[model samples]
Target chain A: MRLCKKTLIWDTSIKWLLVKKMFFILLFTCFIFDAPVAGKDIHVGKDHTIQTIRQGLMKAADYDRLIIHHGVYHEDSLIIDKPIEIIGKQGAIIDAQNHEVDIITIVADSVTVKGLQFRNVGTTFLSEPAAIKISKCKYVTIQNNYIQDCFFGIYVGNSRHCRVINNHAEAAFKEQVSAGNAIHAWKNKHIQIHGNRVHGYRDGIYLEFVNHSSITNNNSYDNLRYGLHFMFSNHDIYQNNTFRNNGAGVAVMFSKKIKMINNHFVHNWGGSSYGLLLKEIVGGEISQNHFEQNTIGIVAEGATRIIISDNRFTSNGTALDMKGNSIDNQVVRNNFLVNTFEVVTNTRYNQNQYMNNYWSGYSGYDLNHDGFGDVPYRPVGLFAKITNSIPAAMIMLHSPLVNLMEMGEKVFPGLTPEGLTDEAPKMKPYAYD
Target chain B: MLKISAVILQNLLRNKAIFGYLVLLCFTGWGMFLYESQPEKAVLSILQIVLLVLPLITLIFTTTYYYHSQEFLFLLLAQPIKRSDIFAGLYIGLAIAFLAVFFIGIGLPVLLFASGMQSLFLLLSGLLLNLVFIAIALLVGVGVHDKSRGIGVTLITWAFFAFIYNGLVIFMMYQLSDYPIENLILVLSFLNPVDIARIMVIMKSEASALLGLSGAVFQDFFGTAKGGVVSILALILWSIIPFWITHKMFRKRDL
Candidate 1:
């Protein structure tokens, strides 16, 4: 009886082990076949089985490529929720039909929308719509897209590691209140905006609360408002961009640790326009920029610890309108050529330092032949002071009395900002690369 | 009147002082363009010459010429010519000679080197200034009998316009700084032809600076087409009114 009972226990144990082995095989097969191992291309066009982008997206799985063929698609409010690539074939267009909605809304990680034309996302006062809107996404790229007449182009919000590259956006709004910005970014981190051309919008590039971003090689012109506007952004670098013919060229306000280099600000002329308006900015480096024919080249208000060097200011209304609130800023190695006023300020005392600048209006001779002027160059003329106090006195610009008063102020060193002299004014302009 | 004016123009052109003045202006205009790389800046330097040296020379030369040509004027007066015709002939002759010299000296360089609306405005203002100063010189010549005293008055007039008048305007502006004195400033600017000419050129060249801060009144007055027309008319009136007054003096004088 004992032998029979032991054999029964061994049989049950062997059956249990076989059952576990079958379960493992079933799970392995499910892992291998249930989920796609590689991304597959899903075609959408007139001849393809998939008739529309929305249907293709519905049929697609994760890690799939939606290939839009060469045709115009009247689609709006298309939401992209999967980590897939949407690539357009040659001449592929997406027309929103002047709809008051975004053309494409991206909410997934590792998504890319490339080489598409988006048009006619109409203006809306209640909502800020865009041609391509990316929110709450990571590793998204919106590249080589042509957007026209959109409220906003390539708007990115609450995003990380996103890139908007090689996109062109244009609008025809005549008023600033009716226009939106191109390449608008808000609360984004690690954003890269590069090689974009934007015009006729309120602002070419607008940033708010964006950090660790870089904007490079953009041509922004003819905007109704600022070409580039930065507010409350930190640690951003913008370089090699051309901003021209905007209401005001570029305004960087309430920002810190900004590096602006090799940018060109041209032909920004208006009653209150400026090539670069820096307000409440701290700890920035502005170098190697060209400011030509601007109303005011650089206006610094409440800015601190900024190093402005190696810039060229040519034919501006006022080269540097540094207010008294801006302190601890260093202006060095700049060439100010033919500006009406080299430096105009509201206060009589200067807290900022001006050194090694070559002013075209400087008449001081260099007898020592050391390439530095013997006399310290006073940039603030007496007329600048008069205009600062009584703005109507600007009619006296280039008057004989104004010229004589400026000369007298130079000899006497009175009325015009006392400590605002360039100690070592360069006799020759520094050659820039 | 035309024949008399032609003879006087010929005589004035032959004078060495006028020829030397023309040469000096040529040197200054051409040398400025050659010295500065930018045509705008060269125009600015030439503007200085127009403002300061042109007025001084025009004042001194016109006064001296009027004094030295007294015998010729008396001879013309003794003829059957109308007194208005004689006065008109003298004024026209002086205007034509100076205008010719200025055109050849400065206007040619401006056309060749820096040809723009601003430069053309400078040339226009310079010509107007020449006419205005010549009219004032005639007024001095007719009003003051003594030659040395007339020359002194011309010098004082140039100083007052070029220096003291602006000084006084500046003082007035500062004193009335609390008020919105833009229109008042405009009125004062029109009171002096030199200031008017200066403002016109500056409005064109340094427009970006001038329009930004001078408030809306100045912007409307100076930054518009109407401003150009109005300023030119004011300058014309400046030239004409002074000559008319001098003409009245000459008509009523006991020669």
Candidate 2:
């Protein structure tokens, strides 16, 4: 019995020793074999002068730079499942060829896709698959490339801290069902869209269900719809952008805590178009922007607690038409020069502040020369007030008899919106250099 | 003529390839319906597939039918009958056989899911398209001497009508961009059979909003009674041209 017990213990000890040896061997093999998979550089388009990029990216790790040469590389949808830098040299073309549903979908972190041309996407009415779609990704930079004739060019949704800079997107202007937006961002946060030229899309850059993003220095023009559009997006800063010659310049609706600063809104003239159409916008700042040659400059409806200060509005038709049940907003220290109609306040404008703004037609004098007018200037005109209530009443605007009636009403304010006044308006223009 | 059609139809009905295609269509149509959200959803999802898959099936099936019936056609020609009647019988007989399979495959589900006169219209339109395409295939089979060349001509014609035609139209518009040619554009739209059919069916649906406001104007003009008459005439013309050409060629040419 003693000899049998000793033999069993020895057998168990041998089994444990073999297991320990196998574990070490596996650990060593993994550390060595994974080296190439993690940090390898692959060159594309090696045979031709323009290198062909091979794409079967299950994952990208430890690879510093993936260099793609210039050639049309047909791939199905490739997922950048890990972190990597993809650099295209001499205009490499990543043609998905509409092979699969989507193309170059990224769900990884710290990915950079630069200098590539993409086209020929499949269109499914049920599925809006883009050429380069990034979902739930972070620190992704899509910069310095041209994308043309795609269904949707670069779509990023549910992503954070992404930078879409200096890219061009032009869609095929076919049937409306086939054409899609250039850059579509929905349910996204903390994105920076800067210095991109987007044109001839359904919308140039669209932000829906977004928050805390910054759109700066982007030129959005010649699009079918609004140049830069946002809905249900809040606390976002849009500054230093040029939106010109689109169907409509820019529209901000159902949003709050927004800032529009120092942007150029120019020549977006069309039927029912505006430099900025604000609907249901609340608690925002609009400062130092140039609004020129738009049909309507700064159309406001159902917006409250917004500060409009130190902006230049020139050469626009029907500037600042307030059309809804808004209260307690301030329009201060802005220059309104040669606009067709300065202000049209339709609803009760009792609680709103219109002070310290420079109107080029301001006849009030500054006794102290402190840039504040001694007598208060009313920006809302009597004829404008009437026209807002009855759009057909606009026929009475240029009539001398209607003009005399407007002057009489302004002298003794009757039947207009009650207590609409601009106390402490500016005598001199609010200058910006 | 009736006896000739009976013999040709019975032989075609027995073919395994035709049987497979019938099964494939039924399975695909059923799968499309099952996967879709609603009748309208199925229509929108399968519109492109209908354009591509239906024509392909018609082309291949009709071509094979024409080739297989050649020997039988010669035998029938040896008897006392008009060539026109023989061509008509073979063409109509093959069409009836293919239509039976297509109705069982694409039509039954369409009946189950689709609603209103539009659905009936879609069914009739699909059947008419199949007839036209089958007629086109038969014309090619009669025109080309080599079987491969016949198939090639049919495929190239399909490609021209399907893919390149629209692109060429757009290119033409771009080339003539300086001209005030909206009415001309409307007239030119009738030149392509696919566009006419697409516009007709789409105008019937609520998804006409997909074309935005410009399409509304087109619909206002093209969805009228006059437009409907014109479209039907165009489709009939499309069918008649190839048949007439083939009939004319076959009359003159040595077999």
Candidate 3:
């Protein structure tokens, strides 16, 4: 009876081991055959069996990856409708061959295109042929792409949680009027644009109806129009961006809750050019910005409720030109260094307040030793006032008579708005590097 | 011409105005360098001061000298010197004296503190303005028969160039802003010698950044090497025209 029971236990143990082996084999086959739920990589190259990226995309299921090898592929347009990742190897080239309306159109969410070089997209004004256009897509990342001579470099429309990272976008055309914006977005939210080198476009970064976006570390130069143009975009933070030699540095209009920080605007010298053109903007903070050699540093027209602080304005034609309708704007802790005009306004009285600033042209004494000047610093010069209405008065920019008028007005402030004065002017510049 | 020039130089250098000008310029020139930390800015401020004050001094000094030295002119006229030689000697003597004073007074400090293209440009413009104003002053002296009237006209002309002209331009531009007078206004800027000199100085310096669209246009026209050559030529013409008028009037004068 004991021998029979042992044999029965041995038999059951052997059956259980066989059952485990069969289960693992079934899981292995499932992993190898059914890769829909689990994503896989499809290799595409001239040498690979899948020669085209379009064929790779067709074969790839949702959430799969297309690993493209280094080769030149002449494709007009590729419509990506699946949640896939298209990563190009080093020196991977995508030649649009000048026939496509759009180079790479992303229609699905959670798609990524990285390390690809796109070139020679045809032009049509009716619809801009972008090197990469993400339409109605979310959580998309387009990074490390070098796009040259496209109608538009990267166009994002109605997309959210999209990041455009480290992309170099440039055009070879001489006329910027025919070129489009490098990185353009419309009606989008939560977008991040950083580390972009954009040049020779209509505008460097154009955003209309965009919100909650962060733009940082972009070097935008040589654009025909404004380096950056934003209209109706709100809750945006732009920091650590350098704009140089553009038509005008940046124009922020009809936006609110913007934080412009630590940006460098250099040599935007032109007629009607400004380092930062703030128009019809509300509730923004512009701080730690360095504006050097611009026609006008900050031109505020119809701007309201903004904090302009910690900015350095040097060698500009006019430092702060408040046209009119500017209300409750506070300029504090700024360094105005050798600007032609410290402040110029056309209003009856100064609607904005100035405080705790260091003017290189400041003549007041610091008696209290508290680093604040004893006399208030009034920045509205007589020449500035004259030029507000008469631009031709600028010809006499160095007339001692105008300087005399300013000195006289400083002693007795009446003709030049008496309300415009920095009550606490700093004896020295703030700790700015 | 040489002997007369030496005598005129001795006579003018000993006058109180030159001494006063020397003291004022030295004080302001070094003071600007010490006060403004930026060298370019010091040069610019000093340039503006020179533009405003230099012409006034030149006008006053030249006109007053011409009027005050009536007996001396008569003495020189009685001598064996040519009429052109006397007038030319007097003009050159006065111009060189003032130029030397200004050069040492303003130019030295600028060179010591900030020696660059900007400083050189300022000095050049200052020199040009001084010569131009001297010519204008001499013209007014020869044009008017009376001393006080000549001084008055000179003063009025200086005021017009320095103050009233800019005011008029402002008024005109404000009135005509609706019209596309961009090019028209730029051409009008060259009408004033002061403005022309200012364009030369400001276009190549840091002040060019302050010039907006008008500045851009001015730079496109005046910021180039060709622009510099043209502007310098125009400024020379400004001085020459006034000097030629003065020369003609002095040559035909009865005194």
lDDT of 2 by residue, A1-433 (tens): 9999999999999999999999999999999997765666656675643333444243234555677776677774777877887877886777767653666788888898998788777777787788889899999999987887777878989999999999988764645445678888989899999888888887888999889999999998888778899999999999999999887889899999999999999987754567898899889999989998776788888889999888888766666877657667888878887664777766654667787787754567778877688876666677666545334233222333344556677677776765665667776566588
Please compute and give the TM-score of the first chain of candidate 3 against the native first chain.
Answer: 0.90
**Fraction of native A-B contacts kept, per candidate:** 0.51, 0.00, 0.57
Q: Count the backbone clashes (under 3 Å) in each candidate.
A: 0, 4, 3
| First chain TM-score for all predictions | 0.91, 0.84, 0.90
Better of 1 and 3 by lDDT: 1
DockQ of each: 0.35, 0.01, 0.35
Identify the superior model by TM-score, candidate 1 or candidate 3. 1
How are the candidates ranked when ordered by TM-score, highest leading?
Answer: 1, 3, 2
lDDT values for all models:
0.91, 0.74, 0.87
Tens-digit lDDT string for candidate 3 (A200-305): 8889999999999999999999998888999999999999999999989999999998999999999998766788998899998999999998888999999999
Q: What TM-score does chain B get in every candidate? A: 0.97, 0.90, 0.95
TM-score on alpha carbons, each prediction: 0.92, 0.56, 0.84
Candidate 1 TM-score on chain B: 0.97
Pick the TM-score winner: 1
Clashing pairs in 2: A44-A51, A44-A52, A45-A51, A45-A52
